[model samples]
Target: MYRFSFFVALISYSTAINAQQIELRLHGCQTKSDKTYFCQLSNLGPIAIPAIEYNVTLAEDGRTFPWAEHRSGQEIAGGLEPGETMDLAIQLPTLPLRANEENVSISVELLPQYLPPPRPPADAPATAKTFANQVEACFNRSTLSSAAANGAIDVNVTGLKIQKVKNYVTDDAAAEQLFQAARRAILVCMSRNGTADVDVSLRFDGSGVHGLPSDY
Candidate 1:
């Protein structure tokens, strides 16, 4: 009975130790050939994680912020052996315009290439990932695209116009989610009046921060 109890305790300890032995760290690096930027994903864990083939998910409250966009909900990494890391050459997603600021975090899971990627709904278009970057860029560019508490959010684009409204409730939560999901503006508001609609106009410029022209 003494030997059996010791064995059980050992097994439990092993399970707990291996629960999340995979460690991930993000470092900003540039490639030598083209000088383009990439977020380096390092695996400083006991086990090897497949590179580019692994599954990655961002925690909204996580402190590590990545600048790349996940066209699909997840990305596939190549392989990362213990202490090995790989760089993802994609641009990061942008945070939405909001009254309150929050943090972002990331998590990755290993996926061997032998398995197939997840399939979208049958009715979904193939080009869904293409707009992901555009959506993120738009999120930061629009001030009026988000709401303001205790006052009106007046945003005027260079060539675009803006309209004013009174006393809009400024909830940053929903807009932040919308920025992660789409390329347009989503208003989260509260009001004293019964009116529920306000017209907002904004544009996503590809020449702003992170969207700068190559010639320059």
Candidate 2:
């Protein structure tokens, strides 16, 4: 009966996750070369997961740009490992001229799909248990890190806004760890930029949770 109960719980949890939504955020753009548009793709919320892939494309009107090459999918294997986020940067090919003065309709889709489980109650045991385990989980993940492993790309749009997304963390230690790394990167980039402060809001979502919860 114990094994049966555990099996039942596993099935129930998997089903709930399969219905969850994958959140893809277009933080904004950075011009790398004279003609390349380096777009920032962020897997926002529930938590990052490994083996997840994304396809991004840019279009003008109903037609796609031939010059725009869809780069290879970025994989966040090793998962977000709870209270962790990965930032990826992709530089898309740009035409000699801007396609449209109006905002270009850019689309990003997560392959293999994602469904976030419904939010658990504030007092749920899983929430309480996972809270304390996040940092340790991240540490374990440090071993799985690829030399190429980098978090979602930070976006800096000239004269517009700075959409600064805070790293997800369950505690101060985890938060500080992420902050120090980010600060170092920003300092390096600041030497080439005009300014760093751009007003933006905090938008939270499941990084790429799979499936929805039964309750929600």
Supply the TM-score for candidate 2: 0.31
lDDT of 1 by residue, 9-124 (tens): 01000121123344556565332332222456666666554323333333344335543324321233555676776656543234344312224333333321211112222332
Q: Can you tell me which runs of candidate 2 are displaced by over 4 Å?
A: 1-21, 34-43, 62-71, 93-107, 113-216
Candidate 2's error at 82, in angstroms? 4.5
State which candidate has the highest lDDT: 2
lDDT score for candidate 2 against the true structure:
0.35
What lDDT would each prediction earn against the true structure? 0.30, 0.35
| Residue 76 alpha-carbon offset, candidate 1, angstroms | 5.0
lDDT of 2 by residue, 56-142 (tens): 555555564432445455445565543444555544445436455244544444444322223433442442233223312222223
lDDT of 1 at 151: 16
